[model samples]
Target: MGSKQSKDKRTKEQKQLTPEAVQVTHSNQGPRTRSRHLSLVLLGVVEVPPHVWELLELQRLNLSQNCLSTLPPALGQLEHIVVLNLSGNRLTCLPKEIGRLRNLKILFANMNALTAVPEELSLCGKLEVLSLSHNLLEELPVSLNDLAFLRKLNLGSNRIAHIPLCVFSMKCLDFLHVGSNRLENIAETIQYLQNLQILIVEYNNIHALPKTLCSVTALELLNVDHNCIQALPDDLYKLSRLRKIAMHPMDTGLHIIHNPLARPLPQMLDAGLDALFRYLKDKDGNIY
Candidate 1:
């Protein structure tokens, strides 16, 4: 009985930690100036004041762990905002006006109730990182392909079944995380991600990998764990840049154990990564 009381008390404390408050910081005791770099942190804030938009100089805004069901459209008034974090919020949708933040570089809207993202978000041509993980998103807005400078994109734990072809068009993308989704197939077009360093597509229904995937010679980390993949392309060993493959305890690491791959792969994995790669490198051997 005492343990149950303790658990309840902890829950209450956790609830109290996210107070419905909005705090903004700026330079001085005088009128707001555009030269100041303002930051606002609105934790558990259920509503925002309209006057908050008057701070045109706001550069960073953190509204994480909030109870906000919606945001005031006036949020777009902060044209100079560079980083906007709206994680751990109750937001089901974001205002289209969000596209007005042209100078925005990083946007984090993960862990929300978002069902769809505004297509206008692609208008932020300068965006570098966009994370929309842990949402109800089934597909992405195609306009996002226009983000030429985008480097990192995290859409893990969503309902995405197919990787958008537009995603392969981003030449500068370095990190792509699409884990824990419903993906069935990855296109050979993935080779277009010439600059890709890390690719995570774990916990999915993928049954096969394209030989073109091995063509992404720049890949440093490739994680295709927890999928239904029956075989890996033999040329995969040609990627000398690869440093880790399925390396994690949760994933059971470099040994492709939880798969139905042909014989030598399972046997080679039992011997170690060196043996596995060597098996792929052999020209005259058959694993079947």
Candidate 2:
């Protein structure tokens, strides 16, 4: 009888050592043994296994063009993720735990159903490029001003009507796109963005230019066409680096300031003021 009991105990131990059991434990490997670099393409609604979080050294995650409705909170366990792309999904909001990714630099959350951004995202101190266009956002989180290192921000094609004055405080921002919205004012605070180069606010309801905008010395391209604007501040001509300016014709007329050394104005400008107004009105209606 004692010999029979010993044999039964051995058989039970063998059953626990099966391949399925080994897979559950993942071989008791350290975090370093798991894949540090992971890319999932065309994965449809991937159900992340609990064990996958052990790969905590991940740096980039591209889950674009998937059917994911939300991200697992376990993703925040990856402390090293730098770039995250969740575009072309149906996510309505981001998990607050996402704030744990302190090293994240680039985030693409465009083309989603997001109605609002979590204020916790401001915790990502290193974020540089953020694209939240094509969403249903009505307002931005006030905490967004805390992102000191942000450089590019795209909020096109949303319901946004006003940009908080605090955003103008981001000294590093260079490219800003807020077109195709309901905006009616050019915040005077925008003049504080000394490094701003490209500003696109076309297809809105703005009716005039802010004199303070001339302070942006680095501006190169300014597209404000398709708005109700009827005048251009004389200061606009002083932007030495500006190459392209798109606007509708002023209700008044274009007057050339006399310059002794400058050659005769280009034919486009020399065209009588009446002709110039007609040209601009036609261009604005076609381009925007």
Candidate 3:
């Protein structure tokens, strides 16, 4: 009788070891190893296993280019997740519980159908790189200004009409791309980005360049093609670090081809940035 009881106990233990449960506890090992990284990129997965949230030690999660339209709120339980890539999905919104990931640093949600982002995302104080390009976002949450460490922000190919002034509060911003939008004017507050390196605002409705834009001394590359800009700010010559100017296909090297730039300025553009600056500073001031 005692021997039979021992056999029954072993059978019960084996029955509890189902495949789904094993996937969570043992990870890839026979029934006890744990996965450190979970990547499901381009698998056409429509849904994630509910037990996946149990992976508290998971550091990176890649679910890009999938068919997932929604995320399980349990995703917030991953306390150690540092990078989360959800790009190229059909998701329309993000769960507010995502704010629970205090350790998250890099988040890529580009190429999705997302219409809104949770304001709670600002809680991830450690986030540095965020890409929301090619989405349907028209406006960003006010709380986004709290991400002081954000370095790269790409909002290109969206329907954003105007950039919030709060975005300039990010002191560490190095690159900013807001091209292909409905922006009619750039705010004067743009000069607040002291560390800015590259600024691309091509294909917008802007009719003129702001004088303050030239104050960003660290700027290296500027692309303002396909806009209604009729004149170039003379103060722009003071930006010593300015390197490239892209206005139109024919206007490759500091040349103004398409825009209705007035007088000798268009002629000076043919002579280059040095010649343009000389003409602007000349006492003659003969602009026609």
Best by TM-score, which number?
A: 1
Error of 1 at 1 (Å): 26
lDDT of 3 by residue, 1-288 (tens): 999998997676444332233323344456344445677666676887666678788778887998999998898999888889999999999999999999999999999998888999999889999999899989889898999999988888889899866588888998888988888889888989989887778878888888898788787777776788877776777677754444554333332345667676678877677777667656235444
Cα error of candidate 3 at position 244, Å:
3.8
Of the pair 1 and 3, which is ahead by TM-score?
1
Tens digits of per-residue lDDT for model 2, 1-288: 999998997676445333232221122576555433444435554454455466666677666777777778887898888888888888899988889999999999998989988888989999999999889887888888888998999988889899755478778999888878889989888888989887778778887779788778787666675677655554554455653323332321122222121222234445553444345445446432
Higher-scoring candidate on TM-score, 2 or 3: 3
Candidate 1 ranges beyond 4 A from true positions: 1-42, 244-246, 249-257, 284-288
Task: List TM-score per model, in order.
Answer: 0.82, 0.72, 0.81
Please give the RMSD to the true structure for each candidate, in Å.
6.2, 13.2, 9.7
- Positional deviation of 180 in candidate 3, in angstroms? 0.8
Whole-model lDDT, model 3: 0.78
Pairs of residues clashing in candidate 2: none
Using TM-score, rank the candidates from best to worst: 1, 3, 2
